[model samples]
Target: MILGCGLQRAKKRVEVSRTMGSNTGDQFANLGRALSTTASVLFSAQPMEETILSYSSPYKKLLHETITNTGGGSSLVKMHRDLNLSKGKNKGFQDIYANSKEFFKNSYSDSKTTFKVLSYLSDDLLEDVPRDTIPKDKNLITESGEKRARKSKKQDSTLFQGFEASLPVINETIEIQQKVTMNSDMKPITDSESSVSNIEEEQRQEFSLPNHLKAEKLNNSYSSTYLKEAAKSITDNLDLLEIQKNLAASEIRELDIKLEKLKLMRELVFKRVAKIEQHELFLEKHLNNVKDRVDMIIEYNMDKEISSSDDELLSRVSESSPRTGETNEDYETAATTPLELKDDDASPLLSKSIYQQLQAHERKADAPETKKAGSSKKLKDAGMPNRHRHRKTYPTLQQFYETGSKIASFPKAHEEEVICLDFDMPFGTMCSAGSLDHLVRVWDLSKKKQIAAMSGHLASISCMQMDQYSTLVTGGRDAVLKLWDIDKAISEDNGDHSEDTDACVYTFDSHVDEITAVSFDGDNLVSGSQDRTVRQWDLNKGKCTQTIDISFATGPMRSQRNAPLHNSVLLTKEPPAIGALQCFDAALATGTKDGVVRLWDLRSGKVVRVLEGHTDAITSLQFDSINLVTGSMDRSIRIWDLRTGTLSDVFAYEKPITSLHFDLDKIVISNNEPTIKIYDRENGNHWFCGEENSELGDVEFVRYKHGYLVEGRSTGDINTWAI
Candidate 1:
């Protein structure tokens, strides 16, 4: 609208010029043309400005696309038009066009045409006129720029006047641009000078030193010298530290090697120890086998010697018998002498008396028969029994009791406590010990080692006895009796350390309670139990032949159901247990816990007599054909004549008697003390056979035969003292 108003004013001025002269009208015409051209150029620049601004501006397209995308169903053209119209005039406005590419092309063409038209007009207007024709004026400046050092020149022509008005402003802009260019060109020099000054100030402050210090001017050379020295010293120290580190590493490697060697040595030592232990075990097993073989060899030699001796004696007997020159029956009778002696001496005595009576009759009838009988007697005297050779001369039991010392101690007789011990009497070569471990161990007294270990009893063996024929009878707390063949046990033990199979000959479970005492003579075995009964068992029958109930209380008798030997005898209504039992010939002597000794006739099974002299329980008692020896916890040993039933002798001790056994000449007694006391019946001498401070323990059982006294201790030791 402003351009249009300018054109109208120019047309009105042209009419006024036409009314003036032709020259004035021509100048006005030119001025009008210039104004029109300038307007046209301004109008054409709008499109070019939009093109440049849109090409450079990210904000405009972002705003347009954002609105276009965000408007959803809204018109895309309407949103783009609104974005175009919202750009402020400062950004230069463009006419609404749907295609920005077509708009950009049309704007480029218009800009080219506007530039050519301006150039063509500028070519005509920039004619180089004479300097005197152009006027320099000051009043053409605007009133607001009064402070301007320079002003526009006035011109006669209107176009020249407008041009001259803008010239000073353009020149002012040019000058300001030149000033900015000059400052930019001088920046490096100014910055370089300022940095140099800052450096000098910093150096002056840093090395200013303190008062009273005097030195030459500080320079980089002095600082560099000390820095080099410090660097050299640090490098030297680093080298030394590296050398030390290398040495330390070497030492660690050597130590590791040594540790490996030590580990190998330790492993080797452990292996060697294991090997040695295995070898020791092997040696121990081999040693046991060797010992078993040696025992077998020794037993074989002893048997061989006995057989050889028997052969020699038979030859002598055969040779000597023929010299007597008797009939076949008489020779047969003479040949059976050894057999009759083994059974009983009575048959041999009766036979000999009959022969003597016949010889007396023969002597009365003929003198030749008497001489033959006397010569036969001399030959019999020369042919002594072979058993006499085995008999060795030894001190009597009294002499042994006085001078005997513990010649041997067998500690490992049983694994448990020894409760009872018995020897194969007369020789005392073989002895058996019963222990709490339910095992009976037999030891060879001559060899001093265990020969057999017998296990059969279910409970601890309370009492045991070994007869002359190697027959062992053991009674246990199980109230059962077991018969063990000592010969079989010894033979089986030749192969192994323990004998189990066939070691027990028989187990007799007849008693109902613990068997306190047991004794056997010939075929009859008697056992006394806490059941207040005495039982007699037949070895041939393996059954109880008789049970004598001693209790005065009237009750059902388990023994009377069996065949009764005789009428029963009742005594002691308080019921005393038979503690001590001894069987000899046809009599059974039982001592009750009440200290009364009863002699029962085995043929009648009736108490023949009761001997009551003991003040305490009878611990042990033994009777022969003539005398009865009884030892009691009352500390007294009483000797009573079996026929009279009267106490004949009383020997006292300081300690209570534990066990006692007597023969025709001497009585051997074991008391609570370690010693075994002996009383010589013929010499009236009494002595002990143990040390005063011996470790014999409490003697549980004692056996004295020949010259040796063997006592079993509760400590599982069977100690022997011999003279």
Candidate 2:
């Protein structure tokens, strides 16, 4: 029986042993499964832990206490539950757990290790295991909870007071571990056992730990002191980066501004260069023109020198009479005698003395011959011959018109008529035409001849005048005021006969339309045109100096737009007629088609007065020392007091007076009628009359030194009478 009991007991012991081993294996499997589940739960609950950790200091303290009481392994479950109950209440419990598992798995391997460690301790030691080894059991049970509460309170105080101060050291240690794992030389932890081995190995070689670990330990000891310094460093670096960015932006802006300024400067330089080139070209052209003008002046002076030498030679031939039967050489010797430059060269005083001697000799040579009486000194000029015998017979009327009418009959015929007969000057001459022919014949009663045929006018000559240099200036419908050198043309014909007739010494092309009248000061020539414009021409330079518009009083003609016309005639209303142009000392007077006499101050180009009273066009105008006399188409002659611009007298004429003149004693007026009448300037009384004629154009008067009056008629007739 004993033997059988022993065998049975042994079998029973083997069976019990087998059951225990199976139970232990089952428990290990269960523990491993539980650890795996815990690990998954911890991982899934990572976001909840992070949310709790990110709270404000006081809130984080409460959360840390809750976590410690729940235990590290179960904290994730509790966090998921609490989060679901709080703001994340919409999430399903299972979904929350799943997401948390993913989060922890990505974040940390420690989560799985911690759960596995706790599971192994619980399976091996059962209730005898330390509370910390089985953190979930201890955290959940009421008895261990109290201990955790007390520990958590103490931790809370430290956390609130100094947790921030330890964070840097903890981060530094974590960073060191990460660096070791990332290094190419380091081996990876392949299994949990290997991880555990590595941890033990790390602890054993503490003295030979990596530089990162040593740095971490030092950081932990000094972290609280360095926290503010590290923060300050980060902020300073940020500020420096911002400063650099701003400086770069400012530099870009400055570059843009500089580029714009450079562009403008380049444009200015180009303009300056172009202007300089233009100025250089203008200077070159001006220099060339000046050179040509200088050359012309030199050539003209040379010609004058040659002409003066020829005159001296002719004067010597006239001064010395040649002997009869003299040889050609003898005559030539007398004529070629060089004038010696006298030492006491004709003194300035001798020039005047010589003129006085010549006048005295003329008087003696002109003395009448005396008849001798019966006795020696008989009645000293015995009674000059009968007054009738001494009387010079005047030419018959027919002879005056036949032989004396020739234009060459006048002395000094080479000179042009400077003053018109209508002017107030004592020697002014008038122009006349018997037919509609465009011929203007000027007669001088002093010399009794046709002085000039003022031609070159397309229409009937309307007005004429002369400048200071005796240039025959005429204005007509041809839109031109020509300055003719009557003397030069005549002298050229008589002397060389090769000079061109079309050649004018000087010409002005200033008037745009028909030249109505032309007058001159000593320096400037003034012309009035049908275009209602007045231009002042510089006589010496033969160019226009200024032009003034006068169309304000009479509006511009619309028929003529901006078209340019040549010297061709166009039909318009009876064309403007210029009655007279009178120039005083410093003023100019003009009578126009409107019968108004306007006066202008030449120096200032200002209108002085408008003399108005005539009802018809003023045909002729004359000015005396005190009065201005005007003959008009109204068949009357009117005189104006110049100083006051008032009418002094009006004399009725039988016909419209066409010409007027003031002869020291009377005013003479000529019209188309036969008779020429003279009126006294003071009283407007009829003074004298000339022989009748069928057609008369103009009349003029001549004053003699011996008080005689001479008259010239347009029909080539002249008469002289005592004043």
Candidate 3:
């Protein structure tokens, strides 16, 4: 019972130590169990030995020698002898422990004897027990009794002395540990608090026991290391995800840069090729001139009657050079004979055209002489462009002016005067117009209806264009250019022609001033603004990628005595803005309000030439392979030879030109006189004409199906005509 009580006390002490963060409590607990187990084994080993001995009190001295070892009782007795047990205390403690266990056991098991045992083991009975076994100096009450129960006072040494001796060694080890660690402030650990701190760190690093024992340890306040590992793993995964996302973004950026570079390179290559082709055409034309001179020489020496012309092959008076038809008889005989003339020399005699024809003949030896109209051997033989030989040139003065027929007209095509127009797309019979009403209107020639109206500009719509597929692009005085997806109207879809168009695919608002003109050169958009800037936009990026400052490209503004007025005010000084813009292969043609038409190499941003003719602000300009035509408020249309940079011709108009339309055989002039007139290309004679009953804003000869006209008028209407 005493052992059980001591074990319960030790258990409670371990709980308190664990709470205080002491790890050595577990070792103490193990030592206590070992002692309790050994004592119990000793007591059970000799249970009946004492009883039998007392009963045979007569033979006590003689029975000692006669007793036999039972269940190794001799070894147990020897163990007790070697233990150095305290003499009186051992006997007293054993008796009290046995009495307590018996009393407690009987009090619980048998109600009749429970009271007797309880009284026997109570505090009164304990007071009657021997009191000399333990010493009071060692904190024991029984040993300090007034009588010397044991004859020797020095024999009462205690286990507490040994326990006290080991404490210093524990403290020294703790001090050593303190020297190895740092404090919260990172200061050197000191021996003053070493014992307590070392015990806490050791307890925290301790491991729990078996599953059943770990139940209590799990409730400990300190968190386990596994929780930190889990959190670290999650953080690592997040970091990895961030790295992957960044890499993917970098890859996409690289692809975009590569694509943009490729587009620039493609444009450059195409321009170079076009230049090379133009040069070849020029060289070929010069070569053909030389060939024609040679042909004239061949024709001169033929057997025809010759007028008295200069001669270099004759002596003073005889003029006895070889006969003019001297080789005729020889040519006839040689042509009939198999003469061994060199094929190489003969090849040089053939014209490039003749050479191609012979080669084509050889390739299609079995083909019939008949041919397709646009692409045919007959057109090649006729010395015409095989691509469009069947197509007629521009109408004659009589055909366009006197013979044109009215096709269709829209009386209310826009809310205000139309300002700009563009055709030449494959729309079959449709035209697009921009107006001062800040809207873009689409008119169908066949149906004669306003198919759609696109509005986004905050100010007047200054310029409008349609791409090859009839995609609409418009720019306005608001400095904004918008690209629209108008495939619905272009395709003539029967589903929803009445619905208003949606927002533009791209809105370019980079210009700080009004946008004067916008044009598409292939997929890229070039826009000139009153900000004195021209920007090239990438369709894929929906943003400008290049800017050209034309500040250095202007010519001196020519003053006019009688320039036109707008809002009853005479235009005075030069406008520091781009008024007209056009993009071609590797080139940008910009006409400012100063009437100076400057052609810039768009890629290099360098001015190639400045064409000066118009005396007032440039209204419109057009360019083909051969000539540049400019119309202005000076009431004049000037044509410049593109090759020679010289003014080729000039025509006077009755009023300021609103627009100029150039073709291979005609130049259509539209002015503020409410009339559209046509002129013959060969003779420059005015012939056919039309009337809007108001100032004409713009006009365009229909593409593919020529002689058909779409006109934009000042009174907010569209008119279509035919020749």
Using lDDT as the measure, the top candidate is: 1
**Tens digit of lDDT per residue, candidate 1, span 1-723?**
878999999989878879876655565666666566556655664664343233443333444443333212223444345545665653222332334334334212355533332232211233333233433431211212222223235433334433443454466558655655565577786765665565556545764222322345333346777656655555544544455555567789999999999989977876666455445534643543444344434422332444788889989978886565544332121112221223224465333432343345444675555543443343232221111122122223224233566657898676545667888642234545455466777776645777778887776677877764467788876779987766567767864566464667666788876677899876678998766788898664355778889765223443534523232111121222666899876878888767888888988988878898888878788877789899887899999987777889998998878788777777888886766788988888998776666565666678876656778776667787763
Per-candidate RMSD, Å: 43.5, 41.0, 35.3
Q: Candidate 3: misplaced stretches above 4 Å?
A: 1-402, 424-436, 489-503, 551-576, 692-705
Mark the regions of model 1 whose C-alpha exceeds 4 Å error after superposition. 1-402, 426-429, 494-496, 553-576
lDDT of each: 0.61, 0.48, 0.55
Per-residue CA lDDT of model 3 for 1-723, tens digit only, reads 887787788667657656542334444444455555545545665554443323433233223322212112232233234333645454523543456444233211344333432333322224433333445433322311223233333332233333433454466568656655535235534653664576668765864332233444445636757445544555544544455555567789999999999989977876666455445534643543444344334433334544455233234334644555534332221011122222424577443232344455555778764333212232222221111112122222212233466656777666665666665321133545544465566655444675666666777766777643345678776678877655344444443444344534557778866666677765468988756679997553454678987655444322323423341111132343565677886777877777889888867878899898788878677788888888777888888998999999988876777666667877777776555777777877886567554344434222222455566766666666654
Error of 3 at 316 (Å): 88
Off by over 4 Å in 2: 1-460, 467-470, 494-503, 554-578, 682-684, 693-723
Predicted candidate 2 versus true structure: per-residue lDDT over 1-723, tens digit per residue: 554564456455545545555543343333333333434444565564343333332334443343333323444555444554654455434444466554344222366544542332211123333233444433322312222221332111122123433444466568656655554245554554465556557755764322123445545666765655555555544544455555567789999999999988977876666455445534643543344344334422332444777789878965795646634332121111122333333577433222233233344676643321111112111111111121112212222222212222233322322122221111224343322335545554433555455445565444456422234566665566665554344334433234333323444556656665667655467787777777776543345667756666335542434545442222321425455566755677777667788888877877889899887776667676788888777788778888899987877877676666565667656665545566764565685454455554234322221223344444444444433
Best by TM-score: 1
lDDT, candidate 2, at 332: 22
Q: At residue 25, give the lDDT of candidate 1.
A: 59
TM-score of each: 0.43, 0.37, 0.40
